[model samples]
Target: MESKRVLITGAAGFLGSHLCDLFIKKGYEVVGMDNLITGDLSNIAHLFKLKNFEFYNHDVSKFVHISGKLDYILHFASPASPIDYLKIPIQTLKVGSLGIHNLLGLAKSKNARILIASTSEVYGDPSVNPQPESYWGNVNPVGPRGVYDEAKRFQEAITMAYHTFHGLETRIVRIFNTYGPRMRLNDGRVLPAFIGQALRGEDLTIFGDGSQTRSFCYVEDLIEGIYKLLLSDYAFPVNIGNPDEITIGQFAEEIIELTGTDQKVVYKDLPQDDPKQRRPDILKAKELLNWEPKITRAEGLKLTYEYFKSLTKEQLEKIDHKDFSEFTR
Candidate 1:
């Protein structure tokens, strides 16, 4: 009777950290890795005391070397947010390509199943309404968001190669917008951004008239989907997200209501290549993994708002005001 071991890259990130919790709770010996470029150690700090948990302060894009058997490799490392990828586009690209290369190699060496976290961004400005896994996507390769988008595309390409050529077991999950407790209030994603502004008693800024739409999945539901996918026999991609759709303007109102903040909505110009709509067609996930998001927006939002409220005064004040410049290459 031996415990399973899992290597979770970006284990300090909001999503990655949550995976660590889920795996550990399910009786797995977890090895967490992160460069902390955009991850905060505090997210995974509590797990440090667990006997079965360990962490590596290394960036996977550069090199990844882990000792002992690795039963699973969850490649969750990357600067996932626009602000993060914009500031460190090169790093994002490298992690998605080189970092994934390293992990695939590790998985092959250990004969372990690997799951790489892809994004809905792959279905860039998607021509299809609720993007099915079959949609090829409508992406501008040189656009501002292409760094993250293309990197993920490359990651998926190479991952499938290993599965096809090298015969390594693999999984890919196109994650939609996920929000929860450990979310950085300044990650520049709509959820945290709205929460931060409302917490600080500032007007919620809506870019591009807030007409653009996004679908949000609760973190717990997303983690469950990932977990089921890993153990399943599927090798292709699966969309893991809540299909409930809402516009930025409408979502802003929801946040204001949940937080009891009197803040009004303000508008700003939309950034280049921003998706007008994003909702996952999870029919494949539902059929294959028997998964669909269970957390309603109201329940999830209230929980997330309380988490934001529990932040320290200084953390609450740490607003990200860095002006982002697009990556042209």
Candidate 2:
């Protein structure tokens, strides 16, 4: 039998790069595309030497053209972090809208299965606890964070349209907070922020009294769920994340202990539109994909700490001073 050919946008990203590694290990011919807008080449630099791996430094927001028939297309190219999207809001919106449309067109041409990487942020400041896929989000249309959230919401809408109108095979995975090795230390997400602060011997900054809660899924577990969803027969968006909730304050303390740092807690005003709580109910994932997160928070954090420790002193310094205020604008 012939090997499957998989095309992944944002293939150099934390999750995308890991997906490439997994596909290559499974003997699939993998093509990774990234504009390197926020994705670092260093993440997939090692994979360049792999015989089954190929890469394209192209922006998915623009046109994407490829030869031959593709068996799969994973459209994951977009600015995921608030800091990134805030700085490049136009690009964020374009990738989710135009980029997804282009990829869907390509998938239709090749009769290939396509999976879009959606986000739990689609449920903006959601009212429901342990949010299921059935709940319509409580999103603010004109909020500062709306650029990214609404773009994803529109992405899902168009994806479903393609599936229903064009008869395209499509899958959408609503990713929650995911962290692990290869994550950009300066991404400005909560995990990296806390970890970077502790590593730099600075005060751990907690916003809004540190009472806001989030459920984190280790990268490995997230990747496993993504792979399962891609192969499953389901088409609607499914939540894939760990359901164990922890307060931001408690999470910061966990980082301090894990990093063996003596950093003290410092409170700051929470950013506008910051969600007070987030936890995905993965009953659909469990029932359809038979998936659950395997790596506990402690185990995932330790592994991530080791990866952060392996960075050179200069890289660590850069991450230490990374400005997060830009993400809010």
Model 2 TM-score is 0.96
**Cα error, candidate 1, residue 95 (Å):** 0.2
| TM per prediction | 0.96, 0.96
In candidate 2, residue 237 scores what lDDT? 100
What TM-score does candidate 1 reach? Answer: 0.96
Per-residue lDDT of candidate 2, residues 1-329 (tens digit): 89999999999888999999889988999999998777778889999998888899998877789998799999889888887888778888899999998999999999999999999999999898988999898888788889999999999999999999999999999999999987776576999888877777889888899999999999999999999999999999999999999999999889988988788999989988888889999999999999999999999999999999889998766544434343332
Which residue segments of model 2 deviate by more than 4 Å? Answer: 317-329
Which structure among the candidates has the greatest lDDT? 1
> CA lDDT, every prediction?
0.91, 0.90
Residue pair clashes in candidate 2: 83-327
